[model samples]
Target chain A: MDSDIRLLSDLAPGQQAVISAVHADEALHQRLVALGFRIGRNVLLMRRGRWAGPLQVRLGATDVMLRRAEAGLITVRAA
Target chain B: MKRIALLGMPNTGKSTLFNRLTGSSARVANWAGVTVDLASAKILLGGHMAEMVDLPGIYDLHGFSDDEKVVRHFLEAHAIDVLAVVVNATQIERQLPLVLQARSLGLPLVLLLNMADAAKRHGMQVDTARLAARLGLPVVMISAKYGTGQAEALRVLAHSLDAALEIGPARHAALKSVLSDDVRIERETAEMMAEAVTQPLLLPEQVSDRIDRLALHPWLGLPLFFVAMLVMFQAVFWLGAPLQQGLTGLFDQLRQSALEPLAAVLPDFVRGLLLDGVYAGFVTVAAFVPLIVLFFLFMALVEDSGYLARAAFLTDALMGKLGLDGRSFVMVLMGFGCNVPAVMGTRMMRERPLRLLSMLVIPLSLCSARLQVFLFIVSAIFRPAQAPWVIFGFYVASFATMILTALLFRGRFRNTEPFVVELPPWRVPTLRQVWMRGWLEVRHFLSRATRFIVLGVIAIWLLTNLPAGATPGSVATLAGQLGTLFAPILAPIGIDEKLTVALLFGFVAKEVMIGAFAVIYGLSGDALAHEFARNMNWVQAVSFMLFTLIYTPCMSTIATIKIESRSAAFAALSVLWPLALAWFTSFVFYQGMRLFIGG
Candidate 1:
């Protein structure tokens, strides 16, 4: 696991990270942006469910639950 | 009256402020998009009557979701006098872009920093003077939940409304062009947040975050959620039982004292109509008010406390396997109380397939109406000790059926939307707000009961009493004929002619099943229980409960399904599939029990 760059799913629960880039389609990208997920935004990987379930992440004051597959599309770096 | 539209990013306390301003209790939950349609109320603002419209929350004015489209169409169609943009003060960084977008819409604006108390508690200081100057709008700080600064907010809004100014065509085009640049908009919002806000050196952990740490824990979160639900259901029964019994006794007394006296003056048939048909049927549904109130009270608390979002997070994986999301689980839980609102609740889901699948499975939940009938049968046939477990087993079976139904239809629709939902901050819900919600729903239930329950009861009464001398609820009457026609088809499931007639009326409303039994047997309470005990063995009783659990939803549910789905074919399928499934499931259960236990 590279320290400089990793997928959002790689961030351990309670780990803080900053979004570096998003690798989804245009529509998903826009939706993510509208939810306050964007470059340079600080996000905390608050919790993840078992058996590769959805991940609950806190971005700004908003907490969002995203599927692991969707989480995988976001590239993040340790804050 | 001048119109003002309340607009904001999702979950900014917009609806709460709407209720505060208009004194109208629209549904206010912590989750986003709770207000799916436009809700309007007239209020006297600064002594001038004005209509306030609370539109569904939207992320962006140019967003493509259904809620956004609704807001867009509304702004285009209605000449709103003032656009009151409610911003969550604690999340000003994320909410400012929406405020800016609404500003660009060329409408006169008043900025309301709602949840100001929560923001102050977070150690965030918002310079309203600077913000007002920066945004070129009147800014008012208020706590919608606690009703703080409401008079100031109303005064500011009235002043803004009176001095409305329309945006010039050139300025509108330029503002639109500027908003189209997403990167620049984000940059500008960040800059604005930095200038107009100050934060403490050491920020405290949010109460919501601290709770979510345990509530959303990987290993313990699910168990905790289930325990919470178990407590809720137990509380519903423990607290609701006495009140339910009292209401039932009161209605019984009314029938005996008021309606029974009418027998002397009126003809016997008319006396029977007033007492047996009208009062019995109405009380049968109305007596469940306590149970309904408790259920909604708990539901409102869980939703307003922001726990439901964590529940959604906990269950998303399991729901994903069924081709649905965790929010659908909330709707299904609501179905346990009533299928009507549960079906309507699908509006919270933005995806068509998920909404449709949720609607399809909601009818299978063991609603309180069905639960009442099940309780009657189980208590009469099984021992008191075994009654609770028997009822629990029926609920387990209902869930199994709902899951199997979802799995069977998963291939028919595409899962377009990913699981992305906001976990709103936890708040101590005000009792007034909770009670207002409960009262509103109770009012809705009474109105629906008046329309469907009364009409259905009168029709059944006429069928059983027409042809003047025919024996009531016997083969010579129309109800009996209809029951006889359906009895052979239901015979394999252990439903006899009298039970079949009751089942026919049960289609009108499941609560009517007990009342129908009372009518058919001409018995009540202990006598009715005795009749049930003599007629039904344990195996037949279990089979009958199974049939009731899986069979077609009551008439009101079907009508709601038709309206929500907007498809005649889907409604027809809703009826046919459940009937088929019920028959097959009941037949299997009855045969299996008979073989193992040796009837």
Candidate 2:
């Protein structure tokens, strides 16, 4: 399976996965790296909200909301 | 002191996060790109001061769209302390691309995994520490709703600010190894999001789906939609009454106490300018203020509650049938308040042809200014009960003109892009946001209308006062000469020479249409409405109003179209096409109705 870090939202709550792909351009790639998304991160989904928008997850000691459309591009696997 | 930039895709809780952090509800929703400009505020985090810049939501830094360029420019110019890349935890795969892109900017980054509680309920889990180590940055899980994990996110954010962390250029090579060649680092941000989000669970409470089943259905939906539109139209006039009366009375009193006293001290020319031009202009404009308020209040309610999007979806298929994009519906609804903003709102349509096409058709959308004209004439000529239906007829005429005109245009230049819009999640609207938005709309109307009305009234006063001692209908009088020129065109519509001129002036500013009619008819035996009724029968009065409603939009609206569409020819076409249709429709209605009713 594709392990794009952006696709962490595809996993069910408590399901863990590793990012397989980053799926974007040079500038975008640099920006994402500066934001902490990189190859080989173990991403976990913590919860989902209305319309699959504003999803929460544990990335380090922080949580974030992910738009569903954005979440669809990432390829991941069950851990 | 430190800085935090709240960045995310449209409707990804960035605003909610801002609200949570700043205690200001700056319009958070499930929809995307609602914030057009960056809004910033101060906050204290982890014993350090900070300024939070809430940038507009965008998918990527492609900078193709105007909004995208704005975000990119802001990021490029500002020397930020830390980039707080907020992402929806439920959809991390897609959200991560933006995160990764932001991280690659070589800033100290702290990824906020917001909406964690909802993700957990849906059976998704994320490991923060491991992901942070992998990404080589700090990450925190947060539920902007439940207020969980905010402190941790703030602490991590503060730490990143102090560290001045920077990602090396080799990160792109690392990203390429993870995804395909086509999958750039921008796409990498959301890789984890794609893996994390599950499909939404089905529920019985899908009101939009239920509404769409009927509202988007081919045969029944059109007629039902028409009926619903009629009800809303009727409701505007019917429900807007008490408030109208109260406001009018207040203005009337203000005119007596304040303006009348000021008029006394001024010289004759100045008094006329102050009293007739300024004060009277205010009264003319103020009468419609309540109507604007009520219309916008309802519109705000519709907007905040997410029904406006559903309406767009319901009408998309029909609009497509008419060769208009679903986005055009938004511009049209805005037309009900004013056409200027309707023209500006056309920017939301990305497709060029559709944007131009919508701009061409929007001025014909029967704005609230024209509604005042309709109400003025209808109340004077027809019975109260019959008035609603008469106004309803004009509303129907505007829509028909739009449909027919679009059909004609499409036959010449057709566009076939499916309106693939994502309906935002429904939210329980907060009254604070609704009222603030509503008040802003109300303020816009008041300021825009009053200024134009004052100038228009002064010009009308100058024209009437000119060719001294000349009565209306005389060749020497400027107003009379203009009325005479427009007379032949309006004769078939059964409007008098004076009213013909008034209607022509109406194109300059709709409020002036009323004030000119007032000056012309008020000079004679009665009010403009009564003079209209006395000169022409009820059928003709109704026809005259219908003509005004469907005619060219006011001067400001035309100018706005020029700016928005960036083509003078398109704006000119918008004017002439509608004027021709307005004439033809009025002629048919007046002639056909008179024969049937035996006028």
Candidate 3:
């Protein structure tokens, strides 16, 4: 992965980043977009559960929890 | 009547606004997709009756998800007079694209800036007039939670309905210019937010964030969740016990003073039917009303506080291991209250396979009805100090069965949707909302389960008293014969003929199992305990509780599964799978304990 593009799952808890792209299927991609995870939106990695658990991310005023595999589909750059 | 639909993104207080406008107590949580189906009620707007439909929350009208499809199909199928687009004012930027999409559909629309109080608290000043002018629609700012601008919104809706009817087909032709691609829609929404919404440049930490810092902590969060659940269970028992006891005593008094006197005037069979059959059965299930109410109260509080989403967040990984999602975890938790609603709650999941899988596992959740039976057995078999742990063990087993069932059946279903859940801002639950929810749930329970319970009791009574000469509930009666027929199937699990008869009645409702014991043994309270102690050892008691924990779901749940899944095969599998699992589990427990303890 490029320096500016890494999986959202790789972001440390409490780290803020901007979503570069969401590389998932049409359904998942649309869901992410519907949830305000559109390109260039600032997302904060709020919390990561233990043992590779779901990653809680904040998009705008909304907070969402996504599984690690799902989070891995979103590429982001550190903000 | 004109049809006005309440449309909004998920978690935007659309259902709450609907409740406020229509006075219908549809389930409202601080999370998304609580209203999974279309709910409508007739409301008097300006002294004119209009049917107000509460559509499932959707982010975009063009979206392909189940809820979105339902909303789209509803709009396409029905002639909606007005579209009330509810926007969470605090997140207006993210919500505007949907409003734009609805605008493109050229329905006479009214934009409701809901949660205006929360918006102000967040230091957001939504320029509703400018946005309304820009979108060429009526915009009303309202706080659905506090009923601040609902009347104004309704007035606007009525005016817009009349105005749109005046404009008629011309508006659709002119609106073609407004319809654009997603990119343009996003751009327009961004520009609108920039021009209209004013917020603090640097947002300060919110109460919800502060709480989530601790509640969602990877290490402490899980334990805190468990402790919170334990407290809820304890509250259910501690708060409910006194009320339960009082109700029981009151019913007993009523049976003796009010019902027993009927024996002098009424015939013997009539007295038996009224007092022993109807009254006993009703009271047995009715006594758990307090416990069920408290359970739902605690659940409502947790759900309203937004902790359920966090709990889902915490459990998603583990649930993913079983090919389920975190929302499924929440549904299973709800199953502890009742499997019927929990199965219905599966509609919140957008995916078909996940919904079906969730429906399959929910019945094994050891609902409050089954918990009542276990509580009876535990109180009778174990010391008071040990009773909580014994009950907790059953809960643990229930959770294990839920997870194991999910894992076992995962291969049968395809995993399509990924885990995605919104964490709504935590709000202090109001007493009125809590009371209304608890009351509604209790009412629902009574309406759905009571008829079945009474019918089952009448049937059992008839069976025990039949053939004219057979002793009631004795080995010679019809019930006894039925019990003997099922006895061999239950014998390996250490259930005798009497208990077999009780389990058979339990198929109607689990709470009836305890009542069946009372009727068959002709015992209650200490006498019932003494009888159980004489007939069964501790190992058998443990095995019996385990068997009850995993056995076939009560009759209502099976019917719900059939209706909800629209498949009789799914319902049959639900029953057969649990019965087989229950038998195997109890057989193991009984054999293992007996081998070690010397039966």
Candidate 4:
């Protein structure tokens, strides 16, 4: 992995990235992929809830909120 | 008649489309299923009657969610002529893969681009004709909410269904190859979207983002959510109380002026049964309609505005600590209005274990019905200044009981499905839509609750009136004898022989417990309160309140749990666990308080 690349959770709010890979438990991996998270999809970190809650990300026009623990498994590259 | 099923991802305006096509009420919600699970209607299409079925939405066909499984199983089991796949035109990139997957089913397919009006406003375009030609499938751009190109969509749908009927095996064989390689679905969806639709690489500065700044703020979001909930709950009470009073007065007038004079020819006993027994129970339930309407009205506003999901996000951290997810928070909130719909609303939850756990704890919520009982009892004993404090104490107990129940049962139920919820953009709910949603819930409450109330009251009337004139609720009557026989079990909870009868009948509806008091003791208004004040002390009152707060909420709620969970064992557990908890808690409180106060 490139030094500039990081987990999707590390992106600051308002920062954008492209999902490089999704590494999760088989069920979660399927869910993420089924929800349009692909290798090359661009994602913009929208916001996070209080006390390390879910992170909201804008994948194209759709916004989804997922737990940060799930986001940690998805590696992303800075856009 | 041919069946055309409208299938799609969640919040694609599928219900709006169903309503548009069939001219019926599908009970629209921006959030997931609080209304009809599978709404079907008959429509005359191409001068032939056809069934238009709307199934529950799913994020993916092969997903693990119960809804997804239902959709997949439904498609395989049912012989449907056409599958009309609806896509949010604005979110085609995220939605198109579902379309591709649905296409793989080898059904006659018609692509309906819903929310085209919103897509247009967002500077997006989908060339439907070109896309249809490229994919070799019929596509129509229609905004289901705004009724744009609705007729064209229906016409194309009818043609697709007829074509499927005529070509049958040949068309299925041809369409089987439409999906090709499963691995290439993503790339194909991307390439196809690039060619057919033009959407902004970035959303055009959504209003949802601006509001979400504070609503989902790292620091302020959780507190703000509590504040929003507090306001919603209090608003229902503060607003509904006056209307309740007005309705009460109106019913009183109607009975005195109309029922009395009209029934003057009847015997006094018959009139008393009509006026005091059945009519009073009816009045209690009917007078509560305003509160239920307001409660659901605010619920619709919060849900339709899309803040409910935000609250879900905010609370997921806390809920996660309890072995539940954000979705459970929403169900618990709905329980505040009424546990029946809240338990039903658990259908949106994809996983069964968490949904079952939610059903168990939801009845523990201090729902408005429980609150009604508390208010009546609190006013009877506590001073006006102390009323709020006592009720607030019960609220605290409600939360504690909910948390405690979750903590103790969390091990048995295990954890929840991952919470990856989509936050739909805020759409200001129209008054008509709000009213429709509210009316649907109110009708649900009335239909299920009124049955239980009337039947329960009639049963109580029989128990009181039986054995050939036992003085109607006297010691010799069935109800009174039954209460006394059961009095030993309730004695620790500070509920007496007479209040015991009311509690037993209260399983049907808690709101009628006070009315039952009038029948049991043959007292009303100030006299009933005076009777209570003279008989009970602070310790006993508190114990009684705690017991009522935790017991089986109502019969309809238990029935909803049984039906929704589809497990008689679990439903029985739901009753037994709460009843046991109520007894234990009340025993501890009643005994401990007696020790402290030296009674």
Candidate 5:
């Protein structure tokens, strides 16, 4: 569990993982899901911007940029 | 009547979904609020009708943004029968919160997971029933691109409406209370995904790796980007040339054959006015109509096909260097077609400073109207040998000016409001969607251009027709008097009377500049060529050309800027700032050239 716990940005670009859980509220959750962060799907972190603030992740190749605050909510484990 | 609203984050294929379900492409984009207007259509649902309204995409219902207000107030006031939250299947996690929020709205909601084909290709799977049960709504996975599962989604929506009437007592509740149940629902959905869903095999890393490698490599990427931009511009210029020629030929023939015969029956004043003013004005404006239409076609293709997001992503590095926030790409792209839409598009930028700065810089982007002027002048003056390069140089100069100005204004905007843009999977845009969208944009431009050009030509004719009409050197000869009034101010800028009058009328609409030029030179075939060499002189002509290329955007663009920025001051600044910069730059160029040439 400790080894699996890492900042979502730590995932290699285009590597797959599942959103084990999310910490944000229902509104933020829905927004995240709207951006393809739903649980069980393989999420791929594609590109991260300067200072790792906003990153483009490929949730099945529909790439989207998400802020760290938003990204932090999606707890993922390498599949 | 029961109302069904389509809610989604910007660019989640909401409009595409709307089009697929309703069969109309009201300008879908990978960017936000491509459908700024709320468009509604009815679809037959299980022997009944469901009225669906496409709401503007807003990140939060809490925000004061126009789109947000549309969704927020509607939910607050009206009892929406069904809400179709069009979640981008490829980017589900981020899309989920909107669904949760929509759930809080207490509508009978159906989650339409769009972009599933792209999602599945990336090795992702979703348990539809689980997601549906978890959110306490029916969830249907569909690909808007392929129009798959759309009908099922609609059918589920039909059931939801029926369920709503049956379960009327359970409709209203606090969001917190409702979400407490959704938590349990989500837990069950997670289990459902574990049992029922199998993640598909995504193409192994190399394709994206190679593309991203070349696309983001600091040195290679910038040159590639410029080449790509040049290619797009070249497409706009060269590909549209034939169509433009054809349209021009049509108008020229019409003017000669139809209008020429009609001229004799009319009184001399009416005849002169028709040929010299109205017919001539339409020809000038209409010649560019094909070019505008083609450019819009190219624009819609780039946008709908997801190349725009790639451009945005690739140029983010350069944009950062210029101190423009991440969101300025949309505004800049909008500027290429017309600055007004570009200025208006800046409203999507959450940062006040970024929006304001975008408004200011957008007018300088050399829109289609200025492109017309550049093509006309450079072609007339320099010939094929030098025209393209000179025209390209103006683009480079404008680009340089935008970067410099944004750099100067960098510190003004400290931070951008957090931006999250979904890049829909790249696909070839459908011909039907592209053509319809292109036609709409062209229609908008033509209407605005024609209306403005008609009044403009008539007014200029009237002003010039007064105080001893058309007596050789009389002030009543349209060009002579207006030219006289404009001469003193433009003299220092190296413009003579003929060029001065054209530039003066040019401030009204850039398209009007052509009509003004034709009017000033008496509409002869070689009129532009002769005036450029004789009345304007090389230095003044070049100076005037540069000034016209950079100055205030057309009236339609000004109106668009006002709409997009949601600020009168920002809109006025968009017009004033560019004009001031163009004026100063032209003055410098002309003065420096005069001294250098020892004139």
Candidate 6:
């Protein structure tokens, strides 16, 4: 179970994960936290951009498109 | 008058509700960022007048985003009798934090459950009275789009403000201390939703998921995006072009039937100024109104359908590499239709540097007006078979110019802003809503930009017509003299004296270029083509079109950039930057041609 941890950017399309941690610069993390990407929250990767673009993820009823580069800041455990 | 302000996260029909209350056509669409600035109007509430302010949407009142700052500043400057927080009934869980944050401000508050009809269709229900009792604030459910329960909502808002007016502001509670932490606020929202809302396990999100499966397919998505853009702009052009032509014809007929008879009563100078200088020049720019409205209307549909945000998601990586975001890409595509509205469209972007940089590159989009110039010149010079290729070459050149401009100035206008966007669910906008959206933007453009463009036209008219008795646009007038003065410099770029005069006319509007040539060479149609051939060869024609592709945008664009950026220096830079690029580009093309082919 501990080995299942991975960056959100690594989750393939249709994979669901629980956010483990979000580490980024202050502003980026603030935005992430504001959008409900916190520890223990479930995130479903509905789809992602081609060539490592933004990732389209759903948090509860909200869908957010976060850049892949920024998605790297979010670590999640595959569920 | 007492003031009631609307606040909520984006796309909650706050502006639509404001329109219902005030009967003012403020800009409203499904996108998250249309209301970059606030719009307000006054209405009678209870027995007195009260101002209704529609603010740019904000996720959190305490958040430090640009829209939030605008909201905070409004609160600081004006005393709000009632802060009506409008939230989508379907999005109560995520939207509740904003209402709680506003509650800490201690203002008399009314929670509006807007879009109740859509929420019911999607199987979400809000218990308004229970929520009111739990939070100690009035909660009303209303459909802003369809005006359902508007009267009830109005009555509640009036009652809340009536209570507020009886008792003045309650020391405007200390803003900093009572604010709840993010975790606590989120927990409170969850508890409130549990008590007062019934959200079905499954709603219409499945429909969006089904659509996005194909729309966001890795392989099919990019091609779909390109095709959608082509169809959209083509639709705008083909549909709006006839309307533009009709307006042009109507103006010409009006001049012929209405003004020509007055020719005998007024002096020739007054008549020329009124007819040729003012009427002709302004009408040429005015003919673009149809295209501008169509652009806003179609863009509203794309936004209302929720694909615009997905488009951003799809293109962010590529556009990011070029130092722009996917939002900039849409505006640039819009530039193919017209540059003025495209430049205006940059207001959707929040960051100043990114918006300004997008403005710098948008004018290079080879708008349809420039396409008109290229079409005539390409047909006049190149073969029928080679014509399409030559025109296509300009499209490539236009993109090359945009990329280079982006890359070159990306560092100068660099911003380290994050690119996080919320994707709203898809919904079809009503035809009346779409029509109102288009008309409001058109009215905004006409009211603000018309004065400056008319002034610029008059300035050009004076330059070409001064020194009475001198022929219009001839060697003796100021325009001709200036053209002659610039001819030697433009010579390295393959432009001559008469062509230079037309270039000057083009600054007023690109569509004026053909008429400028007819005026200068005293020819048109086939005769004009023969004269054009005698003036220069195919190479010169290519070089000239290249110059026009990147040169200074028309007067209206400059005025819009001035209005949008609010900086005269920035507007001056927009002009000088392109002028320099055009000169350098054409100079290299012409000189390089002579060196290689000795043509």
lDDT for each candidate structure:
0.78, 0.67, 0.79, 0.77, 0.69, 0.76
Model 4, B281-329: lDDT tens per residue? 6775576678778978998888877888888888898888888888888
Model 2 docking tier (incorrect/acceptable/medium/high):
incorrect
Q: Clashes in model 6: which pairs?
A: none
Model 1: CA > 4 A from native: A1-3, B1-207
Worst 10 residues of 2 chain A by lDDT: A49-58
lDDT by residue (tens digit), candidate 1, B467-575: 7889987888887787788877887788877788668777888877776666666656556678889988988988988998889999899999999989988888888
Evaluation by DockQ, superior candidate among 2 and 5: 5
lDDT tens digits, residue span B1-599, model 2: 46678888765676567767875312221213222334566777767778887776678855345456556656554556777888888889987888877766666678888889978998999999999999988889999877899888777777776665354436434433433332343355467558886433322346644654564344565567567667766677888866666776776678678877867877876676566655665565677677777777767766776656655655654576677855787678778778888888878666678887888778888887888777767777888898898778777777788888888897655764433344454545666767888889889877777777777777776666567667634556787777678778887788877777677678888867766665555331124456667777777777788788878889899888888878888888888888888888899999999788887
lDDT of 5: 0.69
- Highest-scoring model, lDDT: 3
Residue runs of model 3 more than 4 Å from their true location after superposition: B1-205, B523-530
Mark the 10 consecutive residues where model 4 chain B has the least summed lDDT. B27-36
True contacts kept of 2: 0.00
Which model, 2 or 4, shows the larger DockQ? Answer: 4
| DockQ (model 2, Cα) | 0.06
**Could you report the DockQ of all the candidates, in the order they appear?**
0.33, 0.06, 0.36, 0.35, 0.30, 0.32
User: For each of the candidates, what fraction of the native contacts does it recover?
Assistant: 0.50, 0.00, 0.56, 0.54, 0.31, 0.53
Candidate 3 docking class = acceptable
TM-score of every model versus the real structure: 0.69, 0.59, 0.70, 0.68, 0.65, 0.62
Model 3 global lDDT (CA atoms, 0 to 1): 0.79
TM-score of 5: 0.65
Cα displacement (angstroms), candidate 4, residue A72, comes to 2.5
For candidate 6, give fnat to 2 decimals: 0.53
Q: Tens digit of lDDT per residue, candidate 4, span A6-47?
A: 999999888998766566654565567556564546789988
